[model samples]
Target: MSGRKLRQLKEAMATILDDLNRGDLFSIVVFSEKVEVWDPALGEAEMQDNLGRLRDWTESTTDAERSGTPAPSVITAITLENTNKAKRFVQNLTTYSATNIHGALMKALQILEVGRSASPEQTNHAEERPEPMIIFLTDGQANVGVSDTFRIVSSVTAANAGNSSIFSLALGNGADFPFLKKLSLRNSGFARKIYEASDTALQLTDFYRQVASPLLANVTFRYQPDQVEPQSVTRLAFRRFFSGSELVVAGRLHGNNVTGEVQAHSSSGSARYPFDPVILPTTPTANTMERLWAYLTIQQLLEDDDASTSPGKQRALELALTYSFVTPLTSLVVVRPDNETRPVEPEEASFAAADRSRAPSHVSPVSLSSFPVQGAAKTSHNAYSRILPGGYQDMRPISSSGAYYADLILPAYPVSTSASLDDILWLSPNDTTVSLPTGVNGTSEVLNLATADETNAAYAACVTPGGQPGHCRHLKYCVLLTFLNNQTEFLPFFCRIDSFVGVCCQDDS
Candidate 1:
């Protein structure tokens, strides 16, 4: 993972830490080769010492981390002091070893179990309290302990006695979205892929806000038997309900009307939102209700991945197509219904292949471009635009082949001192340079530098919209171009490349 992403992760943690109040009880579990519960109260020096012990334990060099001396496990009650400590802890974290996803989750669940058993509110069923939540963050697949995806899923399910919600944040392209989604779906949560970009921290913090406030816990909706089709109901049971969001319970009623009740445990006490019997037709927008049910059904079915749900997936696809909705099962397609496809316009590039008028320079007699026989009608080479990976390149129609693209030729002439430059670099079609030897006292030789370098942190960056590695290069050399004003839409940096103001971009579009 990039250091940029790691910094954003730290920022997100800081945001969450700052947002929490005294009511929140939190513990962090990060695992790679071994599992460890992070103590928010520990100072940086102490934490690093403990971390060293944990590392040695992983390597079998020491038993200090695993032995009878139970490592400090401080399930922190949110306070300004604890929050600052936690932020420091998060800031110092570094990615290491192979991911131990199973171990990490099990460790988190164990922490939650400890917290639950120790809490007075948990013991009192009537007392409303914050439901246990596990915000699992990882960048890549589990490659260490209990790596088998299915095995890990089953083991986690078995270990999670509290049925604590696991919101999985997949931080980059290396993550397995399907696996995370499956795990979360099985454990009363969901998965979100945080794309690596400029606003990565915002994405993380925004997601945290959605799950931060627990308005109700153990939420469920119930209706009288025969009033609504039981199988048709859309996720009646929920782990928790958050503030500023509707907990929709959708189902197809057997008749026109039905009575139901929403049962939940809120912050105050046991709560029941009971509904009285009413005619379904009292709702004027009948189609709206049907659409809502269809929407919910599509969402639920698409999320389910059980092999038996193949038919359900198909039904979801049908509903998505019928309703013109984009879902996992369906993609949004743009069709040119009128066959009104825009034709690519043609363009041309002309070069004086050989400097016909050279100032005191003797050169080769041959030229890449031939001059029209004096007085003969000038034959024009119309360069039809060829769609390229980087962009359009000039192409001219040849009799033999359908069309032929030309090699990029820049302004150059065979000089007296050397027939060729010390560097004869063949530039790309998008390139606008040619290497040559130095001239008079004031002149200088040409230089061709690489697009990116790890040594120069300022020059190294991801310039592509999709977050692929790229670096700043001259507009003429950089095939893919984006507006300088629209820097926020793409990568992090731009720089100078020789005489040109460089834009960060890869060689390809």
Candidate 2:
């Protein structure tokens, strides 16, 4: 996470600490290259006086000067008064090099295990067993020890042993969302992506509140075999259902009818709930259920093993193709008209390839030139018109293998037909202004064109309608103009073309 994002995370953590209830048992485990837990001294506190001392210690450790210092510890239980200590711990968190995801999970599982093993006198057992959960937050890929997704999942499974659930929060664009989603799904938890924008803290806090509430645990579902057989169900049972959470089961119908009753077991074998028998349409035109089933099956396949060569992956690709659903394995191809003869440049080719690999299959690429130019109606007064010579043109044809459509246009400058070399005024560096020289006739008057500041301002005005600055367009045009003005041979090539016409279009057409 960036420094600003880290601060937002701290604020979110503080909110969580503030909302913690009296009976709630919590632990703060912050990790980067290493894992750090609150001081053991804070955990040993039995009286209200010790709580004050714990808070003081936390505040001292979180001092700005001490932010760079690293501490080595594991986990500390949070009490009523120690909430401040937890908040302090979160506030002091600083960015560290390398992400040790495996280490973090292992440490969290170990802490939960210790909590479960605590004596009855130390932890009340008659009320209920505290649901052990780890809220894993990360903004980058794992680069430290045991970085493999499968290896990390295996380690988490062994350490967790069905005792703890991992709720993952992927922060920013750099986060590996798919990997985190798989990790959470395997552990019977939830996963969410936190975009890089304002109100991230609110989003984090809202997500925390949802995961904090557990309506049910250790849920299992059973369907009638004669009516419908469970071809594929959500791997992680609905172990932790929140207030607004929905439980959906997708399976294939055995006969022509889709009628079955579902039996649900919850609370670690203590309670049972039976759902009403479902009656689906027999001759429905739209196969909504089948499509839903395919989606769930694909998710399970991806969660199980995402290796391209794996059988599960192959099956997922086949299912996606059969259902006409876009998947990571497939790329959408667009056919252009025969008259469009624009060639794909090297930069555009690279851009298309990268975009295709990352973007979701359903979303098509949009042409950059297709976007309307701001203040285009008044091109004469518009500063951007002077900077971008060609203005807007159709994008080059995209490669079929590329993911999204390639829509970037190479920079082109306008060639002047009426204006001669002498008509262009040189900008004086001392005064930072442009002035046209007097005509051959003595009666002709000099005219000022623009100031250096205005020319510089034109660079920012050259932007796409979507509000993206056209830095490449401005830079390339500037370079071409400078070359034409300085080199005598290039002057002949540019002289014959009209000032309003693009050199690239003239040569290509």
Candidate 3:
């Protein structure tokens, strides 16, 4: 977090205080290596002693670290004086240490007076407590106590007595947007990224305004069990529905229509609304609709993923830690609940991989499928990944023969994906082999063991950094290129040719 952003944040906090009324109760908890819960109602000595006890009960620490302990959760009501005091505390705040996200959140939940438990369990009559929500803001990665991202989320979720909505603000660039988003989503809330600009403070207060007014709580969307696939329904149970926001429901019906209902609790009393036989126009093909659902499902897994978008990227790896959830980065290893192995298997140092033959019946196993766990954070940015057709051809000349170029034959390929072949220009004969992969990147595999398996291969257009778009083709297939010998018989005859990609760039007639 930069100094300028810090000042902006303080300003935003003051603005939030100004907006609060007596009906709202709040607490201020800051975390570095330790947590400090500022309760204006309590004296400094009393606050320190109370915090010391809370620390001793939760973690293992020494007397020296006791001073860093935060005071216990106080039932402090919002008031002009208290808000002013809190503003002073925020303005005077200037300290630095490791980021203990887990501890900070735990303290916040404690202040909300939510039921605390060591492990997650069923909560009955959860509506009895006051409507609780936390507007959490943080920058930087977790480095201190319980730095594990998933564990931090899971633990806080387990301890949530009132099931509070946690709207997280990921301020500044490189603020681990994925982590904050996940944390918010799991708690029936959402996350927003705050750009570090002149109006950053405004961004903070504006987001606060969105979740500030609650219209409904414990909202549930229901559909006839027989009408829709139960597994296909996404986000049926939401924590709360604010006045300005609308609920989104998406699912496939068994027939043309399905009956559904919305059940929730409002200020007056319990509320229920019926939505029977909802019919939607289907002018598109079944395939297109299927793709729509598939894309929607995919959006959840690879949410807000931009690391692999650049054409310069050569490879990407998603490792699992704590639990296998739909997230971007992981630091620790955990038991993988599911295994995603590619259908193609390696045998005798060679394997038959899918090629440009048919539309993908299913997504590639290499792609990350999101499996949300209870209390896991929501992810942003769906990752856009395309299958690379195996690897570049080893198109090197063994001998030189005068072969003339003729008409081109674009091989049998799968879908065009982002574009179609147009303005196909023959590659320059002077264009010699450079490095491996040939064009930018999608995967980092080599075709050393297998021939360009046409029957089962994934094909797509690959462009170089120089804006030269072309396809990988065999040298023997690329007109008659004279090699040292019958080099066409060996692997050195393959090269990514210019223009149309696939079996041949220009047919050697």
Candidate 4:
């Protein structure tokens, strides 16, 4: 082998492991000067002394034989059905010289064809096939082969028109776009140019997440009359996918009034599966559809360009991550005060003030929203008062700190209406359930009690707040416990209270 890019290839291998561990399967073939499978096949060893077998396989193979056919020897050794074995086989192999990308794809396609022979036997039951997927990386153009790049790409594309998906990533400089783009489109694959080798793993991970465990396999989209045309929706695609041993498919209802259904057929059983006709009235625009569109577009671009500069790749990433609606980064969001049930609005001025305080001595203060958390207090005053909204703590007054019991006011909430201290087995209330608990205006010494039912839990105030050695609340306090499906091992539950105790200033006037 000649012209092997060891470091870049290792980075690619690491990414394959990370993605496959998460249930995404992809084959990697890197091309530089020549091509070789990152993973090689090994015959069963008769004895431990057979370490010589690997060395002989590595050092003795001639370049002509190794690169002889468009299909590398690896094709005969790996198939979709034996993919797991292929994985183990690759793990034990070493990197080889040359990065012949087209050669690598040719080898991979040959490997995949073998799947048709060894594919798992399908029963009358719902059938599924291992998702057909391929990923290719290259830093140079097609130089060592007698085959024209365009012809190879066209053939691969025509083959993929029926099944399998291909995605390509080009790293550093020397990428060939004309060849890459055709290859990507032929198989519905993507090609991207990465400016640096470092970004390969991250880019690969993103690619895998977008296509892995497809919700619908062998899936396609079609349009109906009177419904909006499919092309009008800029980024119509699957937002999330669920996987089993069967086929995967996901969809969104187009326009608010538009109606349609998602259908899938298991390759094994040839069973037609259908999801509810998704209907939407609101017309989707490019900006709104960018995320889903990003997945496919990024795939195509990565296959075509080698734009791996930090800022350049970042722009690609922002697009890719946005469209990857299935990943966690696209899922979680923190609630703002206005959007949540918090009473106090977040102060904008405080954010600016905090930023100014942290600015460098010689530099003007940059406005910021909050100070960073450290072991010591950044502000002199009341820093300890910061509390988690809707959170509870076992609070006690400190005499050494000169803290005094003051009126603690908890607002009336849903818990007051439904939970009584006795119902939760909290502190024992007078044991009488109140028809209606007293609201803020109606004041009485007795706290109204409520009962827990089948869905809700019984809450009673435990004299001990800790549920162990015990603590206390001065106000009429109680404990509440909820039983989910009647299974109780003391799961943490929330409580709401109305009455609070506080210290008031004696009127000198």
**Number of clashes in every candidate structure?**
0, 4, 30, 67
Question: How high is the lDDT of residue 16 in model 1?
Answer: 85
lDDT of 2 at 320: 64
Root-mean-square deviation per candidate: 21.6, 20.4, 19.8, 21.1
| Candidate 4 per-residue C-alpha lDDT over 212-280 given as tens digits, one digit per residue, 9 for 90 to 100 | 555554343333445443432322332222241111111222333333334344435323333233222
TM per candidate comes to: 0.60, 0.57, 0.51, 0.40
Residues 1-509 of candidate 2: C-alpha lDDT, one tens digit per residue: 65768888888888888776544566666556655555534443432333213211121234463233222223334465467666655655556667878766766676676666555443433355566788999888888777898888776876678556788888877778788987887787757777554446755775676567665676555545664544544442556655433344455545544322333434354676544442423434434345545655675687678566999998887776655554566543333465443433332121111111111223221111001112111001111111111211222324343233333333344432333334323323343222111111001112332322223222111222122223211111233342344322122121101111111112111
Highest TM-score among the candidates is held by which one? Answer: 1
| Model 3 agreement with the true structure over 103-126: per-residue lDDT tens digits | 778777766662233112212223
Q: Is candidate 1 or candidate 4 better by TM-score?
A: 1
lDDT minimum window of 10 residues, candidate 1: 362-371
Task: Give residue 196's error in model 2 in angstroms.
Answer: 2.3
User: Which one wins on lDDT?
Assistant: 1
lDDT of 1 by residue, 1-509 (tens): 44888888888889888887556678766676766667655456777667323322232324343333333345756667777777777777886557878767866776676666545542333344557889998888988766799998888888787789999988777888789988998898877767676556755775687677778889887778876667766777778766533444556666654666778888877899876532312344223344445666777787765664599888887765554444555432222446443322332211110111111111111111001111111111112111011111233333231223333322221111121111222334343442221111111123344443312223423334333445554433442322222212112223334433344554343
Model 3 accuracy (lDDT, Cα): 0.48
Model-by-model lDDT, in order? Answer: 0.54, 0.48, 0.48, 0.35
